[model samples]
Target: MDFNNSYRVDLREMNFLLWEQFDIEKNLLDPTVNAEYNKDFIQQLLFHARDFAYNELGPNYQRADREGCKLLDDGTVQLPSKYQGIWQKYTDAQWGRLSSPQHYDGLSSPYIVAQMIYEVFQGADPSFMVYSGFCAPAMYLIERFATAEVKQCFSHKLATNEWTACLCMTEPQAGSDVGAITTKAIPQDDGSYHIEGGKIFISAGMHELTDNIVYLLLARVEGARPGTTGLSCFVVPRYDLQHDGSLIDNHVRCVRLEDKMGIHGCATAQLSFGDNGPCKAFLLGDRENIGLRQLSSMMHMARISTGIYALGLAGRAYMSAAEYAENRVQGTSFKEAFNPRAKKVSIMAHIDVRRMLLEMKSKVEGCRALIHKLTFHQSWLTNLQALETLHPEKSEQYQALSKHHESLVHLLTPIVKAYTSDQAWRVAELAIQVYGGHGYIKDHPVEQIARDVKILSIWEGTSFIQSADLMKDKLAMGRNSKLLVVYQDQVKTSIARNRKAGVLLVETDALELSLAIFVKTHALMGTWVKEQKLELIFSISTRFLEMMAEVTLSWLLLDGAVIAVQKLKNLEDSQDEAFYTGKIASAQFYVNNILPGVKSKAEIIAKEDTSALDATGDMFLQRTDLYGKQYF
Candidate 1:
């Protein structure tokens, strides 16, 4: 299991996304923000993050995965020795707190700035990120929702990475169906609850990297109502702090570990709480049965993080495929078959290879753009809230702006999470196809990337799950719900503005064309919602997500291409030329080849096929030979 430093970071693309596309400097300069952020800050951080990824994490990835994690007989999980040290080094660097608020001893760089670091580290080694990535968000929840005393106990340590945490949600019976969890919490006199239950597929649940593991466990309290409404969240730790300040065991047990397909370095454990007696847990704030509501925002953050993981691994796969195609010369050109003197060329020169590479590039970069775009919306919404807090006289103005950003973030979150993860697997598959047979073995990096990315679509939520959310919430057009319409208008405005972008004309047109289809399907979905056609809504929900994600990604890519077209004309350096050139190629290729699927998906949805709904039970009951012979 050899690892290669094949990860490529296009600083130019990062700059383009930050400066040209989003104008992030302008965002920071908003009167609400009161912060100084220039291109130099972004440029410096990009280089630093690149160095950190290549030198610190990339080298350890394969060794860690090969070594994997081990569960001792005593119910302790130990990461690979090398992987364990990297966590300490990572903690020392304080990179985990990059996106945390400053009051907790954090840098609190803007979301997009932090996202650059995420892409690098995840691409360099996603398993390593699996260990460190959730820390900030976990600390964020604690800081926001915990009691002052609980904050005193856990905030700094979790924020500084002196402590680690895991999210405990999935049970043996309940994976995505959070409402079905049976974890029980009994109340005690000391302001703690006795937790008793088992949770499966808890990543980083029982690791030795920290002094204690803080499990953000969801459990139902005694005599609560049923379903998610009855479920409350608890901050359950591996060990409890005694009155004398000495730590005592909390009776948290690692029941077993999942032998997973990839990301072997991160342990996914089955945890049992309070099998012998009681596991102490502090309620997350004073809330009861509002755990689902509280966790929803954090869950969205995790989903976005999952998509970032997909983008990073997909980018790495693309880089590996591109590098291999450049070096691995095999067959002679079919065009020069008659000429005996004709020499073999790099596979990168092959048209089909270019097509695959460009498709992967377009999807990865487009997904990155979409994720950052969502982050930008979230950041602006935060800023507007701050403005509302500071300037009461301008509350209405700030509220309006905040609503706009909120709508964009709400509408785009599912698209980023589901679309990016699904495309990542496709890109990994294409990367393998680009490498031919050599890609299937562990000798290359793409194979592991393929394995790792497969879990992402299933990790945050399944594709169908995300799609239903989109259809049910984002596109739901009631009295206060107008995101679908607003999003369509925004895309139309962009298309209108970019009509003059020379080489991007076709791409912009494609976006415009696809967006029209999206609007049509959106209207159809609204009809289903109005008509109370529940089955129709559920059936075409994923298709609706596809239409939404493809068109939105196409718009983002074409918007980047519009900037690239102007930059290309003014750039003196060939490197700048090449960078802008690639951006243009990615935009053109995606809109021409990929985004057209949005229209087709819309057409399919319009047909309102109910075959799956009408299928007989016996259709899937058994299988027979083609000759009508049954094995049984």
Candidate 2:
């Protein structure tokens, strides 16, 4: 029943990921380019981040959800009582600006490092993170596509957390089907537009946490074409800003607040624009109909954020379960089962409990490894692009390499979002099982963690949406998609190198077999496309995505295991011996146990059974008598 800060993180594992596994020093922390984020500075930053999460964020997590947000009669949404103090401390610490550009009063930290810091914050209170997390992506949109005047007015405030932002794309009618949105924008004389429509499920839509809320809205200009192409992006503020930076009412209102299952501290408001009066805004950039294209970057980052959020929740659950297993004494150990006088041991001693904990551990670590690998590629791409700008003579070379990294990011983003999210739910379930009945109630954090992560797979486009994107867009490149080609090549190269290293032979063999299954399944799906079996392809799309994800995690884990084996020789007497040993065990467990499932899935896809597609509505009913014997 204790609610006092149950959040936990493994700093040593984080250190291993950054320093040993990913090798940020060789990859991103070069003094010639990224001098500011050397080891000392990043390590110090992480420690400070950990302290903030434990002290300021973790303690308020349960309280925030219990109190939720309050929508006042004055049309303003008030957050949990403790939120204001937490928000002030968070913004004052400049934690929001780590990945922001320096010109915008940010530190310009590497995206991977920022993500690690984010995992800490997210683990502490994902609902709290919901308030400030969208600001950076919104700022990026403005900085990249907004006009000089618009950027001048809004960029700094968003970057510095003086104001918060949200992407207003979802309507009640158009959830994932963004092309169906009916929000309207009418041009005015002074080069501005009046926005009219209602947006639903807008996170951080209406709150008193900041003086103003900047909305990166999407609407159709009058006389524009229908569907997604007609949509235009707008920078709509809740208030109008004067030259002196004062605010005037712009008629943006919170029409209603959703009553949700979890993340209650976040204000998911139904917003109305121009319902009561004029709602003025400026279009993003000079274009009018390229809103979807402009919003792609933000959506991409949001998907990545969803994955990180899932990882955070999963990591917290695993840590909680592990801690509980070590402390919660139950029945006697197996060895003492025959003796009534034998002393009881912790649940960690039970074989089934150990199995469950290992399942949680292997999945969490493998997913973290996958996420870090994705972000590392992103960081490398950013630096490569920057180098292209600085060194024009070598621009072509940098551009080519940047293209490869770009492919990696695209290939991994959907998988990260879908796979990590799907796994997080299972991980939370395992944590609850570890706690037995207590996990089902509010007394433990696992139940809340379970509720909070359920939406990750549903929102930001469903996991099925991500899967379709992967199958249709990512892997469907004409002769061969560069994303898939590069992905396979990189994974194959790792497998080959590890095979020569001679350690983890069984694991590497299993990974190699899984890779073949993935490649074959991918080829089979391509053939289905040619054969006009689009329905079957789409039906099995999620399974295909999971196949790719399992192979990816195995590749990275075994690659890390190679490093662990190499380091263990010198660290046998050091404290890191256990850490390195655990790394190998985690990799072995996942590759041997989980990677083989790819083969079974590949067989399922090959069968192409049309039962689900062929089923009649009557077959889905629970009551056979209602359909009569003939239908049965």
Candidate 3:
């Protein structure tokens, strides 16, 4: 496949999801809420984003990976030769500030719209955007918790990409175990703290792309209690700012750069603070022992971003595979196999190949739908909050709706993160399968997409961690959380509405059955908690997460299918017809094929198999004897 051809998305599908399926214009694009973002303007924005992705970003995708990053003697890193120019163009376009608030010199477009645009850019070159991803989250932290002085010092530079920032949470000893972090922050006479510690696996940690790198370091303050609660977030910059805004070395050093399996263009650094001199920093908003709480907002946003990242890569991989299948002629149709005069046909004509394409198609679309729905809630909540301020007399009603949207967002975050990331890898793998040997080679983009997407499932919390969060926090292990209840009601309502319309009845029935099983499994897990059979619950938690995710995806796809069913009536263009037809087919494929796994999973969960827990460590080994014996 052509390299430039690798980065494309079905804009019609995106438009359908944005307009027909979700109908964001009713509230999100309301003149009162977003006056400038009419349908035409949004469409134009998407077109421009698509063009930029293909013309500018797509060409650099493979180059960035191959050239990678180089650590210099002065602690700064050298990026790909083309990266500085691309980065300049990207930042100059102000694309990074689309979703930012107005005070930060941003366009302040709806989050959904901004994310859609971001999906296009990220799909083109995920590695390049890694430098820009955490900047917004760090800016959000500063905007929300930093004092006016600190905000003035850092917010604009981050928002405008004049400088870059990173969230420093992981240490040598602490990954998911945030409470065990031992990085220390000592108080100074002038109300500043000297940070002393090391952070590993920090993306964009050391680079010359921006003037100064800001570290949102999390460290335990001196004399503070132990554990995560005692930690405080600090604004530690590589270069400290004087009263006149002159920069001075703060002794932040990039000790080493990690050589990773993928996304090699991104500089993932092991950083040391105050090794040579004091790393002076100010506490965020004069607060103490609320670092975890402060970082929670950023973490949530990052999780959602992870889903979008996965969706972009998966969508690209699926598109590439679909195109390759249509163009690559390898075999004759089975009916023509015995005929000497029969001509060879494209792989798309083969049944198994078509099945593989459909599987990839269904999953990529399902993941996109899931992420779009999550962002839609985010946009709706933002709109409602604005409405609350605009019309105080109806504030109570708006607040209630806002609470409902908030609950949905909370419920969907982990599902989007885990399910989409896991499926991205699967989709890319299938895309490669569709291309045969060509995909496994570096000549194809699908192979690189697979490598880049694997990190999504690992970082921003692993799939297992997300599952545990879903089960324990989102679902409420002791009982059903209000969040879970709200989500179930939404899925149930979607099923009922589709059934009443007599549209997608088969799909709705599948979803309803899976949902029933999913709910009961939750209750069963709750009982396991009561009986102190915790190991069984933990062992099966990831499976349980997948079950719920499948049910959710099935319902959402069916929901979109219902809309497509109605829209197909007047679609004059053959292309539009095919698009709507694909929506219906995607729904059917997922419900008939993938959704049944929920039932199987529930049965597996009910079995309460403890063999995994019961097996000894030695049982996992391949040795046939106790000592150095011969292996089979």
Candidate 4:
């Protein structure tokens, strides 16, 4: 693949989402929150982002991959030569500060704009974007949880790209199991702790992109309890600062780099702490044993980021495949297949190829809409915060208004991470199928995209972990939470609006069927919860999440379709008309062609199959050879 092949973005769809579907102006244009970020200003930012993504990042995609990071002799991760220029371009633009707190001299940009910009960057060059993944979250957590001095010391540098950060959580035995981590933090009288242990598979863990590397390390303080509850978060820098703010070596060491299957441009490191000297680590605030709780709050943001990352890859793959299909003529059109004289037409003229294209297009669009909805919900809170800041007398009212939006964010986080990541891999597979033999080779981007996106589901947390959280927490539907009831009402409202618009009845009906299935399943689960059928609920949580996510996605897509229908009524036949028309087409395709799968999933869940659990050890084949095999 020519990595510089123009990365495509659906600007019209993005505009529709911002102005029509989500109504960003109503949600965020408060005199307190936005600094003159009106419609024109936002449009200009989007246009500027388009040029930057295409011109700056797109050209370096292949070069960055071809020259990935290497571990240097002095135990530092050295970035590819091409990335220095890319890093310089990124730092100069200061896009890294998009959503950080204003105290750090950050933009405090709205989540919608930042997320949309992220999509363009990811689409342009995901591998290159990997180096930037840690900046936003670090700034967020530090500003919120760190001591004032710590925040003053670190947040600005992180936001401004003067320094970089990495989160060191996983160890040999503690991947996803934070409680099992053995990293120990021993307190010293000088107000710093000594950190000792090792972490593996850490992305951007050790790199020379900046002057100093700040590590958000999780470790068990001496005498603390076991599990995540025992864990405490710390800020451990690779090079400690002196009284005058000069750099000095700390005990942080980059032990080695992992040989990964994908994302070669990213340096996945194994870090060993307190090996050479005192690894001074500062406790986040003055608190202990609350690190897990504080960190859990940021997990949703990370998950949402992963979802957008998935959409960017899926969108790029689908568009590339579409371009390939339009030009690669192989077989005659189905109507003329029997005629010997019939000329070979573009593969897009074939019905099967068209089906594949629509499948990819609908999924890419659906995931995009889903992610945007999640951000839109979060934006309500962002605006509310500004309102509270501006009108301190009405702070309580603003807080009350934001409560439900907060619940929705909690509910949607896992779905966004799991569903989008899972589907991105499938979309990449289909893109490869669209390209046939050529796609299987390294000559195309789809194959590399496939490898890159596969890790998304595995990282952050696996699909099963997300499903468990959804079932065990969100499905509890606590008396105070509006997650279930409010979401159901939102879906009903969208269905009604779409029907009133008088368009795409078949698709709306299909979506209604999926919603109906979900309603039935929800009631069934409520009864099971009341009856205390824990086994049955746990057994089917994964399917339940899938059913709910698919229904939610259908609702969002149909909402866009309704907006498109209204827009098409006023526009003349032109590029704008075609754009609106395509929105309806993709929306209808997903509801009719893909929504039925929800019914099947719901039916399977209703069956409560337990044969897999019922099986005895003797009934399953045991691999004696595998058991006997050993590694030294």
Candidate 5:
């Protein structure tokens, strides 16, 4: 029941990502920080997070899922009794405001720390984590754009975990396509607006733990334009409080709960607005047309969080598999030896199992480092004053750099969300494989991990949706010339550095051939885009994204290696020596084994395989009919 212990391995990995890999301690020591922050503080925070997750929330995760939430006819949703205590503990610990500003009762921890803590909580019980994570973003929106009075009225309560928050964006007619929403907001005599219509898939829509629930409602104003352009965001609370701040039931009504594939402990509710009457709602931001834009500010953060969640889940899967492999005894042979001169040995002895486990470890750890690095950059942008003091003459340069990185973050968000989730599922699947028969049974954690991770790819956005976004929006953003130039410089610099090191893994001929293929593919993409060959561009974008991911990961590993080699030379202990040696090995693993795939993809892209698009409904029907159910 102790989720903290369950995520102990992940905590270690996260620490490495933040401190050893990203060097967040240096960033925290910048002059802009009001109080000195160091590794000790981070360690303490992590310790607290582990304790809170394990002692408070971990025990109730399975219970919450089993009991789920109940919606009474009186418009109240009751959660499991266990959740009440856990919720109280969470708030009392002041964890809700860990990343918020100090003036607002927040600890103002760095994003990497927040992310690490978040991983601990999420890995413990993502169902409960969803409520707090969702609420944090909503509070952030109000803090950033809401009026002073509004902030005074709600910010403190939300930050203190007295009030819960929900993002109400999806309606019956609209899911991922937010622009098609038809919820209406009529201007009232007061500054508030009267909200009507309903929304679906509202997580934490009706929970009993918090006194008040703040809903970030997206609605179309009366006589306004259609689609996302006419939409506006509103702060609609579940209850109308008195002058003294006592709760009275308001117009927000919970119609029903969604029966989902996973995360059943988290309430996904169907909500009706103005059911009993009109709901008074306050507008967010000044511009009515900025609804989508405003929502995006929070969405990006959510997307990043989702990516973190995926990483956590994947980490859990990897740990579960690794632990099982070390303990489970299965077969006997020179090939599948469980023990020396014994009939059975641990699954870890098997080469195939080891390969899968190592693959999972490499990807999960690599992605963890990447996510933490991105979070550090985001924190740097938010705390620009500190950056300015550190690089006075280059203050503007840092600002521009921050903006460029933000674009890169936006570009990579979908991939992180989509690809990480997808890969996590693979990890879970491999975990099941490693467990053999035990993995499929309900008694083991592998089944649960697999089921839990399955939802990640579907949530935030589907993988295909992410693919389209990467191609249509991210890759095609601005002139893309600048981005391309930046990418080329990076690849060139990496190649040059590796060549200088004289530690190249790939054959010189192979490296040159791969580089040529990449260049040709890049040129082809440019020509296709110029000719408005949308289909051709779309067809190759996923491959291009993969190619780019390979290149970026390769660069990161090489960077790690460069540092590791320097450290190894000075280190005397075997453990330290192994650590640095592993870094070098991991880099080599990526470059030698993974980088070759880029050439294969490049060749495919060059060939322009559009056979799938060419297939018609009749052809698909005929194929299915001929194949029949038995074929599947």
Candidate 6:
């Protein structure tokens, strides 16, 4: 698997994202973070992540995938033997607890570093990474909301990787529609509740690597109301543990394992609770009807991880295509006029191939920067209290700053998860095209990467869900007047920078038009809400998401250009020169080729396109009898 080389690329991207692009070190050194850790210590932590990814974990990724876990009829699941050693290595190294609290034998490293480690793991093999990655979020939720007793009993084990966790949310009928979940929890005399329900698509639901599996099950209490508001979250363990921490057989059962398209190594099990009897479960928080709100915290983390997955895939695809183009010889160059006996050159010399490669690099890096920046903001938000203790005088100022940062993070989350996944598919396809015939076969990694990245767009939340959230929650964060002022201020800053750089003049103009259209569209959306135009809002939500995505990405590219110019002036090394050059070229490519499309989409949103409203079931029915199956 060449773990060292693979993670070297991942680490390079991570470093570029954190220290170079976002200057996370500076943020960490702020009075808030300086009270807890120093810059050198943080750097050492990042180094540890690099070592773990390359030396320990990356080697077993492909082997684990090819030799997936097996489910036994006796209701036991066994992972590949190779993963057992790798999992142990990761746990012993405390890699699983990178984001956990320091009191629980965790490093409590910054989120940027954690995200960097996740990127390395995802690039190595996303399936194998789930064993620990899935547990981190569960542990995070417990740390944030669980009682002291519960934390005392489980936090150490989870942080030490003695137990793994799974988020049990989806049911057979309630995939993406959480309100329809029918899982029930009945209160018992012992203060604990008895949970009886079924959960499907539970990743790492039943695996042999841990002593016990902690299931963060979402269910409805008996006599509770319907919909997501009445739902509550329960902590259900696979095996009952005595007060002495000894295991006892429990009633939780694995009904079946799903045959998935990719990530075959991670067990996606269908779990049935209490078929034999009621299963003991403890509610997380004292408050009721807070299940969805509690779950939202983990949801954001999951979305971030999903974005990381897309970024990793995009990077892998770019490396594959770049390597192929530099080696694969094709047609003669256009500058062959100087030589009568011109020879074939590398495909990179061809215009179309170079164009495709540049486009992939541009989007990959742009999306990487966006995701990493969001992660940095989240880490800062999480650790702000710790920061406040160090600088109490400026605590109020920092709190105000954190509020704006939180809003920015919320606004960017959907875009990071949705747009990156959607664009990653295109990047993967281009990588395959660059390889020509070899790409379609298993000889190259592009086909697998393409298949793997497809899950990102559909998981966490679908692109539709994200787009709707952007239009509804993100835009409606405050009064239209306040949001407009903030947005206009941002636009003005970009315009100022653009006017100085003398590049992206056309893009700058296009951005202005896009923002104007967005304002009008937003006004229309408010009116629709007043008129109760739910269907119309639903119809235009997807297009609205696209418009926001384009504008945000364009702004990010322009920001990159501003930095690239500074680097170009002081560029010292060949590598830095090439990197900066690529940055400028990518930003230009995006502006020239991509940003123009947003105008047309904005027009559609402004006009309220409802073409789908007129479609009939018969249009999709079996027209083979009348027009043949090959009608297309």
Among the numbered candidates, top lDDT falls to 2
Candidates, ranked, TM-score? 2, 3, 1, 4, 6, 5
In model 2, the clashing pairs are none
Error of 6 at 525 (Å): 2.3
User: Lowest-lDDT window of 10 residues in candidate 1?
Assistant: 28-37
Clashing pairs in 1: none
* Clash totals for all candidate models: 0, 0, 0, 1, 1, 1
Off by over 4 Å in 1: 1-3, 29-36, 388-392, 477-481, 500-503, 624-632
Candidate 3 structure quality by residue, lDDT tens digits, 1-632: 23444678778889988988788877468788769989999999999889889988889898888889998887678998788998888888888888777788877788899898888888899988889888888898999999998999999988887888888889888998999888899999988899999999998888888889899989999889998789899999999988987999999999899999899889999999999999999899888999989988899999999899899999999999999989999879999899988999999999998898889989988888888898999998888878888999999899898889988898899999999999999998999999999999988889999999999998889999999988888888837678878987888888779988888886787788888888898899889988999888889888998998899888888998898898788776776788888889988999999999999998998998999999997767757767778685
Candidate 1 local lDDT, 467-515, one digit each (tens) = 8888777767322357877887889888888985556676676787788
Per-residue C-alpha lDDT of model 5 across residues 1-632, encoded as one tens digit per residue: 33223443445556656666567776544535645457887788888888887777766666666677888888788776678888887888888887777777777777767887887788777888787887678888998888777777788777767788889988878988888999989898777888989999988788888878999989999988887788888888888766897877778999999887667778889999997887888888666767777877788788788878888778878888888889888777565345677678777888888877877776776676667656776776666656677669988787787776676567567767776777778888988888889889866666777877788877776777777776666655213455556556655666676677666435333444555666567677777877777677776666776666666666666666666776777887776676677667766666677779888898788787888668677755443455474332
Per-residue lDDT over 254-365 for candidate 2, one digit per residue giving the tens place of the 0 to 100 score: 9899999888989999999999999999999998999999999899999999999999999999999999889999999899899999999999999999889888998999
Per-prediction TM-score: 0.96, 0.97, 0.97, 0.95, 0.90, 0.92
lDDT for 291 (candidate 1): 90
Which lDDT values do the candidates have, in the order given?
0.84, 0.90, 0.88, 0.83, 0.74, 0.78
Model 6 vs truth, CA RMSD: 3.1
Residue 576, candidate 2: Cα error in Å is 1.7
Local distance difference test, candidate 3:
0.88
lDDT of 6 by residue, 224-308 (tens): 8999999999889898778886887668999888887777778889999999976888889776667999999899888888889
Q: What lDDT score is found at residue 61 in candidate 5?
A: 60
Give Cα distance to truth, residue 404, candidate 4, Å.
1.8
TM-score of 1: 0.96
